[model samples]
Target: MVGEFCPRLVDYIVLVGSHSTNRTSSSIQTPVILNRFPPTDHEDFVLPPDVALFCQPEGCFNVVGSRPARANSDSSTPVRMPISFVFTLTDKESNKVRYGVCLNFLRPIPRRPEGRKHSTSSVPAVGEMPRRTSDVEFSQLPLPRNSDRRQEDTGLHEKKTQRARSSVRLRTHTLTSLCLITHHPFFTKFRALVEFLHTLIHKLHERSRSKRSDRETVWGVLAGGIPSTTSSLVTRSVQEIEIWMLRLLSAPAPVPGKTCIHLAVQPKALMKPLIFALPDKSRLPLVDFPLHLPIQLLGISRTLRILVCLLLEQK
Candidate 1:
């Protein structure tokens, strides 16, 4: 009877094994069939992973083997795969070890416009680029020294001095011409003497007339002695004219080498004849006496001519 009981127990174990296998096979087959199922007009299907495993407790287990070999697939075909890494965290409350795999699948960052990059490493540092050839040449060039600038200034000064000398020579020539005209022989001999007398007489008459009119009472006594009065007036007039003439002749001309007489003689000569030709009373005051008048006029002419020449030279 004990032997019979053992056989029955073995039979029961076998029966359970067969039922378990059938159930596992059915479950696995269902997924495969569904993956292989044809797509409907409105629906698409996706295949499941070749291997999958679940962990229910803290333990070590091999979840998958190496990837299956691909058959006749292009080597260059891009593959999409999930990358995983183990992470361990300790549970504080239970003091238990927890394990997880981080599926941090890496993806290439999308290129920006013209493939620009934001990260610092892709760009050059402050001084990494090649230096320009032009810049190197400019740095090697020598600076302009002070001696070059000094030579330019020296040349400019020489040009200025030459201009100044030319102007001085021209002015000297002009002055010489004016002096020659004044001292011409015809002007000096005849015309100059006449002008001198005319100027002298005019000045004397003017002085005498002023004195007589201003001192009428003093002249009233002298008026009765006509001869004495005339003589006295004439004498004074002649003396004053002579003094004025001498002064005019002696006055210096403005240009260094030229004399007053040389400069003024011509103009004075021209003026004398005009004065002498006037009616007696209208003539220059003391010209009625012709004795020294001509010589005196000559002196006056020389003086006036000198003044005019000086004035022209200045202009």
Candidate 2:
């Protein structure tokens, strides 16, 4: 029935097995298939282990491993391990790729072979399988001598090892590319500046509390360290960046690079410019300025709104 519908279903089905020696017994090792679908162009696909076919069926539906042998079948026919299933796929070139699933099958240990005159007792029997590379016990291998050099040894080899170790530390910088605001050098500097400002503000408050009459001197000291021009420049740059981001968000389709800018500005009407949020959160309307806005400004706004509400309530 599968052959009639999916003619090339048998092509992708694969069987893999291995052998291992454990103590006095030997067993067949089955290779694992990580993916059912074959990779396409520019993609790498890991191929299964190459094993001699014990049984081949016409199609996935007619796979011998999944079915029981007939009651009257000859005993000489090896019973195929029935732990795998088959599936099909069609690629861009219209070629059918059949994929199969099978478990690793372990067979019972057999007696030693008898054919060769010089064959040692280590030789496997005619029906017995040989041990696979993965099945080799680590305890059986010869131990290596301790040849590690002390860190104090300033040889060329030690220097090379140190450099390699340092290079691994440098690899952590690669993660900075994952996010701009959180990982960019600019943000790092901005964070340091904010910390310095916070410390400065705390110091200023303590000084003002002690010398309540010397308000002008306190303002002068604060202005001296952080020039007005420098502060203005930083503020203008931040606002400009925010405006640029708002424009990008308002565009018909935002570019992937600026898709990180999700600061939603209120639109006058439904036909006004659209701000595209990440698809997961796009359904809800989000309106807030991006980045950490000045806390002082938020406090001032809250105080003014409260005063206006009080005035309205009294009227």
Give the per-residue lDDT digits (tens) of candidate 2, residues 102-146.
232212212223343564678778899997655367657776545
- List clash counts for every candidate, in order: 16, 6
On lDDT, the leading prediction is: 2
Q: Candidate 1: deviation at residue 61, Å?
A: 99
Report lDDT per candidate: 0.30, 0.30
- Minimal lDDT window, size 10, model 2: 172-181
The lDDT, on a scale of 0 to 1, for candidate 1 is: 0.30
lDDT of 2: 0.30
Q: Per-residue CA lDDT of candidate 1, range 135-215, in tens?
A: 779999888679977887888888788665543322200000000011111222323343343444445555665555322
RMSD of 1: 69.1
TM-scores vs. true structure, each candidate: 0.16, 0.15
Lowest summed-lDDT stretch of 10 residues in model 1?
A: 8-17
